[model samples]
Target chain A: MSDKGMNLTLKIWRQKDAQSQGKMETYQIADISEHMSFLEMLDVLNEQLISEGQEPVAFDHDCREGICGMCSLYINGEAHGPDRGVTTCQLHMRMFNDGDTIYIEPFRAKAFPVVKDLVVDRSAFDRIQHSGGFVSVNTSGNTQDANALPIPKDDADKAFDAATCIGCGACVATCKNASAMLYVSAKVSQFALLPQGKVEAKDRVMNMVKQMDLEGFGNCTNTGACEVECPKGISLDNIARMNREYLKAAIDK
Target chain B: MSVVSEDTFNSTSHFMGTNAVVQFVLQPILAFGVIFHLSMGIYLDTQNNKARSVKYAMNKPGTNSSWMSRNMKITGIMILLFLGLHFYDFWIPELNTKYIVGDMSGLNEHGGMRYFEELQHKFADPIWVILYVLSFVFLALHLLHGFQSAFQSVGFRHTKYTPIIQKLGNIYAIVVPLGFMFIAIFHYVSQL
Candidate 1:
């Protein structure tokens, strides 16, 4: 725990760009501070690469505080680097030991194509949300009174829980089938649970699910893996709720 | 239990093997269901694999999902292999008698029902017994994730009722395979 930090071996996937092939390249670090966040440790590696006249690794990160949902890496094997309830940015170097061989790769799925070494395109999530991730409220100066609508405590709380999903692709990366059901379900549940989202609930579930399928994500086999690896610990109940919503919407339509 | 008494076994087997409804209606429906399930599973497994064209260098799937849930395709293929052997052992013979050879009499040369003796003769082989028992284990694994999963696919989920269904699914998964295994071992042991 003194000034002599941990010496580590890093196996990182290096890709020139989306079209180029990728491979795991090994690197060595002499002293990595355990207090450094996983992203910060990568920064050290990139800085080392720059000084050595080698190409730096490409990765995604924003809001190092873990709020932006932009940081993504499949560290070792688990998404967000083996820690629970935290994104890769929040993962610390302390989780590993000295001389540990750490494998770092991008969050992978056909829907989330690898843009570079550790950056995958997650715009597929955006497309699904675009279809029906919102409520149609009047904002043309005829806005309704916000406080007038009262949602029950239980329903509001559940909605808030569902709303906490940051649209990260970790669920897809962790899933064996690479299913996006959890992410889609969280969005569907957030809206389907409240009065503001009730009017278009059926159409919302229908369109979002349709878009999700169009994105080529695999079907859910109810493995419950996504829920376990989710950084926000989003409940599997949201998936069940989405199933119910989708079924009802399909039936009524 | 049937192996202990020739008369009891023949009566029960003859009843089931010769009954018009069991032969004509139930068997056809059961056959269709098994074929449909196997085909659908193969189709989905292939499609899912195609979704992930590239493989990961290191993956620890056991950390997040149960082994049974993650390896459905493997267990499913195991069950498929078992079914091929099972149909050869039992269904082929039944088809030979009922349709090809046209012996629906359920009789032996001595003018007695042969169902009990035929059943015993099949289990007399140690290899068949061992293979059948091993297949039942795979069946149990397949059902462990499958039973509740089917309900989930149909969207029959509730806070109070879902947990109950999952528990019931586990019981069903265990008991059905256990029942098959017990009968298999019992028949093989009783013959000696």
Candidate 2:
């Protein structure tokens, strides 16, 4: 039952730039270990490429521990590879057959332009976060008592869940409209539930919506694809919350 | 005013002038005005139904009114009924005259139709006008909930942005329909 000496084929996308003509080049690897994480297999392949004086295929990975949110890859038509809820780094080679051909490609989005190969410039997400994502809390180490403001358990739980968004562009990549509503909503919800956020809530929604529109993100058709592909399973409820918040802001203004 | 020639000025003046009055104002108020509201209401209803099914499937069994889940279908249905009555009194007849009978009396010189005249004619009954105004009241209520809820459903209800969404909803609900109502009331009174 051990796959200590199995061969596999990798058909990876290769493009020089966003506008470059990209094609899938095939590579054959022999004697791969089933126990190797998907990324480790890539490391072994890279070693071989380097030994042959070939430029290793470029891909993004930082903190292979899966929390840094830097690893981005679409494997065989699934975001972050197969095995739901796990990022690409956590995927193991045991999931694949010995002679299977795995198709690997970069996450696609007009807003997320591809850099070299698997790497994409995800600064669009950063800009959206910068627009109106934070509360204007003074950083003077003014520690307020935690129990001074008692948020309902339900609200607190929802806030914590929304706050777990890691700013990965997977939602945007998976959405047919390329909508960032899920990401934006999570940011909005995180602040909205707390008393500290209520003071600037109105301006935040307005500014964020204006920024979202300005960023050329397609309108949300509510296909629910983003939720399905999201690594954290961020729900569509957050999108609903954002819509309500935006409407409230508009009326107040 | 100068004295008009007996041959030039005929008995048709009063009737022609009345027809002109009807064409300029009554037609569009009945036709497009009602159709616009009705179509919008129907569209909202469809969207609401979709949101309802989605929420129903997603919601846990014992959870209480979770804002967006509680309101989408109800608000959508209320808007649909509001627009239905609005159309029954105004749009149906106007459309009948404009399309089926090939009547252009309600239209203006710019080829744009005047709806106020038809509204006045219909609302002269008082019962129908009251019904029309009632529909608008419901429309206002529906918009009040819908505008804010749609954003929330889409995850726009952030701490910083939620208040803004609420404010915008209130304005849309109050201002747009109230403007239409003002015109409706003005025309109805002038006819009396």
Candidate 3:
């Protein structure tokens, strides 16, 4: 009590597997230092559970500094806890108060199903990327030199902004309709803005959008929730760009 | 103004009843537009619901998006309900008189042009006027998000123009509903 260690309650989703039902289970922890990251707090809870001969909570994390986009959670109804522009791993224990009850659950979408306690199968994102999220690179000794084509500074910066999206399902998880338009648009705009990407932009947008829809993601109603919950600060402008790109491609075809 | 001004109301009503373009072309087009918008809204909402079949245990939607954007379904359904009452009040009776009853005279029993009187009578009752005013409020709520959203849906965002479109959308949402509410209130108050 003299050390000022925080006492907290954690309510975590517990699911045996994808087919089994899940429920929120609560755990109480004491003496948690405020300096630890949110993941570290969960680590302490998991260690305690193991020592008590109980199964530990299962969650996903990698590159705890927040670049990999591997960690995804719906904390207390938010995509990555209460903080803005930070992933769950980047979230700190200082954000929570002593005796606070924290709720953690996996991101929910028809396209993202639970794999374990807080691990949902986000491979749907991968399939959408596979559809056309890349540029056709020439590697047969005929590749054009980099910067051969001049890109407008504004376009380059915007493309870089769109390029920062880590493919995390936060946008999808946060959207009411579970729309992936922001994510798909970011992928589309990254290339659409650049000369290299513009060559095949027509097919890229069309195929990627088709794949996105086939994965059972909802259509965008332009609520713009995805931008607010995005850890990378992705803009709603990307979704608008994607909509325009899709329309242009549809018309041209 | 039109409701209180009998001359303006009757001539407009008479022109509307007798004009082939208004009766055939405009009315059908308006009806189709309503049906398309209503059915599409319902279909999209149903699909949106299916996207997340499992409900969140403890989540807050208000932190991220506007209330109007989040609750389009509620506002849209309210507008639909009002449309039903509107059809019952005006359209059904108008159609009955013009078609089923075989009268296209657009005149009252005393032949003084019934359009103004009929419109006035609807507002004479506080309940009907209140219903109309309330419906206009819902219409404003629906358009607040919808006006700008349609442009986004169509991929029409320009750095210079998007802001203007958003501003225009807000103005349109406010002005259109306010105008309708004004008509309802003006009629009701003038009679009083």
lDDT of each: 0.90, 0.70, 0.91
lDDT of 1 by residue, B1-192 (tens): 474677887888888888989989998999999889888887778768877887788899988999999888889889989988878978898889978999989998998888888877888888988998999999999999999998888778888999999999999999999988887789999878
Ranking by lDDT: 3, 1, 2
User: What are the candidates' individual DockQ scores?
Assistant: 0.71, 0.09, 0.81
User: Candidate 2, overall lDDT?
Assistant: 0.70
Give the root-mean-square deviation of each candidate in angstroms: 1.6, 14.7, 1.6
lDDT, candidate 3, at B24: 95
TM for candidate 3 is 0.97
TM-score on 0 to 1 scale for chain A of candidate 3? 0.97
Could you give candidate 2's per-residue lDDT for residues A10-87 as a string of tens digits? 988777877786777889999998889889988998899999998788889988876778888877776676666777
Each candidate's TM vs. the true structure?
0.96, 0.60, 0.97
How far off is residue A253 in model 1, in Å? 1.8
Clashes of 3: 1
Clashing pairs in 3: A77-B59
Residue B116 lDDT, candidate 1, scale 0-100: 80
Q: What is the TM-score of chain A alone in each candidate?
A: 0.98, 0.93, 0.97
lDDT of 3 by residue, A163-221 (tens): 99998899999999999989999999999999999889999999999999899999898
Better of 1 and 3 by DockQ: 3
Return the top candidate by lDDT.
Answer: 3
**Candidate 1 lDDT tens digits, A181-213:** 999999999989999999999999999999998
Candidate 1 i-RMS: 1.0
Model 1: what TM-score?
Answer: 0.96
